[model samples]
Target: MPTRTLAGRGRRFAAALLLLAALAVFAHPRIEAAGDALARIDKAALAKLTLDEVEGLRSVLELRASWLVAGPLATLERLARAGIPVEVIDRDPAARWFEVTIGPEPKGDSRRPPLADARGREVPQLAPVPLEQGVWITAAVDQAAGPSTMPGSRVIRVSAAGGPALAVAAQRVIQRVPAARAEVRDDPRIAALAAEVSPDRLRTSVEALQSFQTRDATTTGALSAANFLYDYFRGLGLATRYEDFTFPGTIDGVRVTGLPATNIVVTIPGSVSPDQVVVVGAHYDSFGREQTRVFAPGADDNGSGTAALMEIARLLARGPFDFSVRIVAFGAEEYGLHGSRAHATAARAAGERILAVLNLDMIGYTDRVPEDLDVVVDTASEWLGSRYIAVADKYAPLPIARRLDPLLRASDHAPFWDNGYHAMLGIEDAVLNNPYYHRATDRVETLNFDFAAGVVRATLAVAADLAQPSRAPAPPVGPSARTGFLRSLLSRVKLTELAWSPPSDRAAVGYHVYRSPTPHGTYQRVTGSPVTATSFTDRVTSAADQVAYYVVTAVDGAGRESNYSVEVDDGTIRR
Candidate 1:
């Protein structure tokens, strides 16, 4: 590494240390060899490139700290040892990027992003949290101050909790700094359960999710995705429901309001301690930068997460747990985590005993270049985060990199943490922010399904250990299961009156009515919402003569749905 500054000018260094675009796609021996050779570039290698070539390197490298580095992972250790001071400033895990300030700032075009959000509001570089004294997360820095070329302009203060490397890194780049490290081990009981995870199912689920045009919070796609998950869980005999909330008003701390968002919720009740619960959540929403109506194919942003969640649901549904496991396909997470905030707030208000939440955000991306898993943990959920890491050690092949991002509140997991629940996120390498993220290019083809499966297996390990699932009967007991239908015709319209005895169970809160032309499979809800009373009037106008079969299921306070009552019909239709 050369240490020199040209007269009246900062050194113009080329950033192509290693890992260029073509090399980034494959993890081959040739690429590895090139990276090794490039890592130790001396005066001899540096002289071969002309100044013009040095300037052209910007296409492949980025100005990070004082060094023009290929990737943070490839350069962080070298920079640290070279005695080059590095200060990480602003970082967006969703965007999979970070901004840093290094002393002896290099001269090129300073990559100071115009700091403003969608509404033209200045994005804060730092803000004080009401938590502990001297703690601050990145908030909007003063816009008037503009850009400064000073050595420490990018440095800001931050305090975080997690592994030692993370703690140290947090302090090293803070516009100001705080404390550090952690380790985890395996639980074999969980590994045996994780072994049953089917990678084929995981890929199939992702493919199904990507088939939708767009799952934006404001679009009908959101509802459609939710309904699909609802039916899937319902078929598995698990308690299922749709948790709905409007956006803007739904998400906390966000000023925006009145967008539609719904979370598909499914629960596998604990056999013994049914009240104790564990949550495995994933956001199903996708964004395309003002292209909600068009194709925003969110295959990786969250289609991967949503798909992985389904695989977990399918696996866990086969067994009953000691602690109830609720798998939620959260909507509007792309819209500032509105769906989750709504659910968590309600869960907290109702005094639900949520033991832990494992959120899988973007687990389907791997440059295939760097196979790493970034388990993001905050100060609040360090223990839960460590447990997940230990589980990954036992069942997953992806290398783990624990990052302490106390201020990184970018996913569904954050809302659970706010509601005083232990939550952690499982994601692809945070450093390798997928190139196709948030774009129309983020399709299934861009995802590494094999890598995603490993992440799911790791998550399944965590869920199995925490929930400790067993088995349940085909249909739950203690609910009154009787129903009848009466038909009447007026004008050209046919009306069917439906009635059912209330479930004898003390916990019964409401009943859900389902109707379908066939005996099984696709069923539609006749009632707009859950009916509190046992009787209801049904209206239908159809000239076609065909029989419609109906069934009713009772729901309890904990969202448990009883077995369906006997089917009722509007007298067999005569053709």
Candidate 2:
């Protein structure tokens, strides 16, 4: 147990301020290391101190036997003077917290479900405890179908991929959040970057890893996989290293200790703020049936995602960004996310400023006609998911299913979320539509390259956007404007058609059209969003007499806008 003393008034005040700052920013509030022993200050001693001292002590000390007091610091100080003993209860050593995604209860099974995967295997759902919104700490067993002890009447302990499992207990569930639509827009630079993603390259990377057979953390193949990834990144001339760790857990029925694992880390230092990081990570290790670890070929399960990470690294390697980008190939993810947890914990301790983490788990193997993807995030990181969805729509254009549940802790992103960092999980299909989730037959051939490439492109676009694209697209040229009429179902609509030539810079993605009453007057943006094409159509009151001056500017992949093109008139009535 850790202990601290509240000796000096100034020291106590500083500690209180630190605690308040932690509470404001982070969900898991923690005080800085205090000392080796707890302060034994009695109620009478506290009564003699000032109001600031009393308030400081309240935050620094733990209450014993549960005493409740309402209102502000004044009330607390009064109560302390009235002889309330301020004692600290020893913290529980066995207490552990998990942040889990809640699905409906399992059907026919009398036992209430613990955290599980799509296949109903018991998986650890470890994350930081969300205190404001009460969560389940212990596994509920043998509970009936009335009401859940979890807050907001939300279901608990089911996988995000287990859609069928939720249907069984639909009657008992109070609420189900409907999947929201992804925002769509066009960016020529993003589209260009996305187009650069090679389906063949993705396949080659996946196949190379699949050839290793088994990448279990304890197996020799795991070391080979790590070396391969290290060499791959090193070949790119990026700063790369192997982050090593030791883990202890149960395999079969026997307890194992000090098993070694390796995480491959690659860093691309930013041109501007190098300390602020954008993380792209995926687990490289895999698992199979209990009997044999030698034949596990985890292609679709994680190979697709790992390949996506490599492809993104390749795209971003073209140039440096405003923020540092860190790519990690995590090991031992199947064995309770040991690699990610260790990394996230160390990052938090070191005060690494992480902008966002895009964690890919299984981003291939779709059976449907239109390829779809699932993005999972917690309450705090919903913006990160929204940005991912928006970028996917613009860059990849695919069906997306979004889940805002922190309880979905099956992947590497969970550890980042646990440490109070913004992270999201991008998966091919959360429902586990693939037949070979954890089987030995999981191979590269089973993965849909079309779907995998699109996912990779989307991930690349977003990662670049977060890292802040360093170069702005060159300004567009050859602007012209003309009036036209369109026959709609309701009536004839008059409009102005603005056209421009593409920029010389390959980074240019789209154009933003602006309008002005006079050539010398203020130009207002006419288009709501960036237009993908070089031409734009703006609806007008009348095509016959309406006159407008127009200008266009080029927008790049990072949403940076270049200088406006030379002004042009509507031609109906020249300025």
Candidate 3:
């Protein structure tokens, strides 16, 4: 009987161990690395420190909690224990985590609860712990958790996307956190805070060129401006390029052929969607005769606009965008939009998808008439321009005038519109508004930086919205076997090129080049031998043969052909 009982006890113990293992798997609890770090921290020491002492020590400690999440809670608890009048922030049971705030204790006479519980007794101090201090705490949690637990406080599930509930919770948490004592010097501890707390420096440098004036289109002024723009863009780490367009024109009754018109274009490539483009442009040329020459200081006429465009380019180059932003300072706007017209025509012919165009012209002059005039929208397509205006108005501090103008035509926006694109023009009101209109007095001093900043801010908002990345369109499936083979070959070859090193890593396994008539056409291998070359240069003299698309495939030792390199149409190659 004793032996049987011992065997049964052993079996029961084994079953209990198995049940514990099953429960462990079912719980699937994950204490984050951060939680482990928090566990190691000396909570007792933290509890003993004063608000100022804790903030001062924050810089040296490698705390795992976010300031937005932990600072308020710590401050509230510390102040409360120190006998400072403070409120303790409550936690929502349905929430994944609790936020704590410190603030002054609430005052006023107690009132009986209007709604009684089962006992018909007055609710006692039903208010959630009020963290009335300015500090805020934010705790992130899994979306599945409902609201967290906190007695006498409203329960809310906070989302990471900064939803209304989250914002309210954050506000409550901040109110509980104790306000830091004012310091004489800037605290290095909080230097890493966001721009809201510590604003970022202006990325673009400002240089004043006193008595700066330029001669005619071919003068040093035009070239210096172009060089300055190019260097500025390059300094900001942007990929810069220039396009030269020649046009026949009759200047002062003198027929001129092949008049050189150059445009300095800087491209900020997108990270995800590089195909879409947003262009900001201004004219670099000037007209009007002065001092035995056409002294087109053009400062207000276009220099101001040009300068603003350059500054915008500088800012964009310092940051990343989801879509390409091309800043083009066009030449010869005074000569009837010749440079812009040429660019627009070429882009249309090449099937360029231009999302928007922001044209800046004569944006200087502090006079209230032009500087304060309503931002004009295109009468032809008010919907496109009006939408941008509305967004700007929503975010901008000042009111934006959305009026249609009849006199604003034949500008750079027209050429863009002609190509079936959405375009808008931003210009100071030109109708007897500025007394210094196109005069030498329209210098840098005459320009209102506040107004320029407003315009720039509006432009940035619109451009940023348009340039945001969209879901990539799904590619078609079930293509022919040959097409799939070509695509695979291209992908492999491209990856190899990207991964290849200097001194040529190509072995004698050779490569095979294929050609296709169209993007969706069948591809035929051009050569049978494994082309052992890293690059295949087709020296075909016939223009017809040169117009085909080419892709390269590498072969391995076992005669296995790798996927094709990046697709390229010889005719569409830029360089």
Question: Which candidate has the top score in lDDT?
Answer: 2
| Better candidate number, 1 or 3, judged by TM-score | 1
Give lDDT tens digits, candidate 1, residues 293-378.
Answer: 56678888898888888888877887655568889988888756778888988997788878789898888888765677788765
Tell me the tens digit of each residue's lDDT in model 2 across 22-87: 443342123232321111233233334333233322211111212111123333334334554322
- Give me the displacement of residue 359 in model 2, in angstroms: 0.5
Model 3 / residue 456 / CA error / Å: 1.2
Best by TM-score: 2
- lDDT digits (tens) for residues 1-575 of candidate 3: 00012223455545543453343233223211121011111223333333233331111111112221222334434434454322222222222332322222222223312423235543222232211112122232332222233232222222211111111112112223221211111222111111111001111211222133652455456566667767877787888877787755445655466767678888888653466688888886655444212354665667666766766675566445556788888876665576787788788778786767877776655667335524544322344355456546544434455544322443576566544455677776634366665565555556666666666655655565455422222111111111101134223211112112111224326667766543213467777675554555443332221124565555666665543343454532111
TM-score of each model, in listed order: 0.52, 0.57, 0.45
User: Clashing residue pairs in candidate 2, if any?
Assistant: 100-407, 101-407, 101-408, 161-430, 188-509, 189-509
**Candidate 3 runs further than 4 Å off:** 1-212, 248-255, 289-294, 405-407, 430-432, 469-575
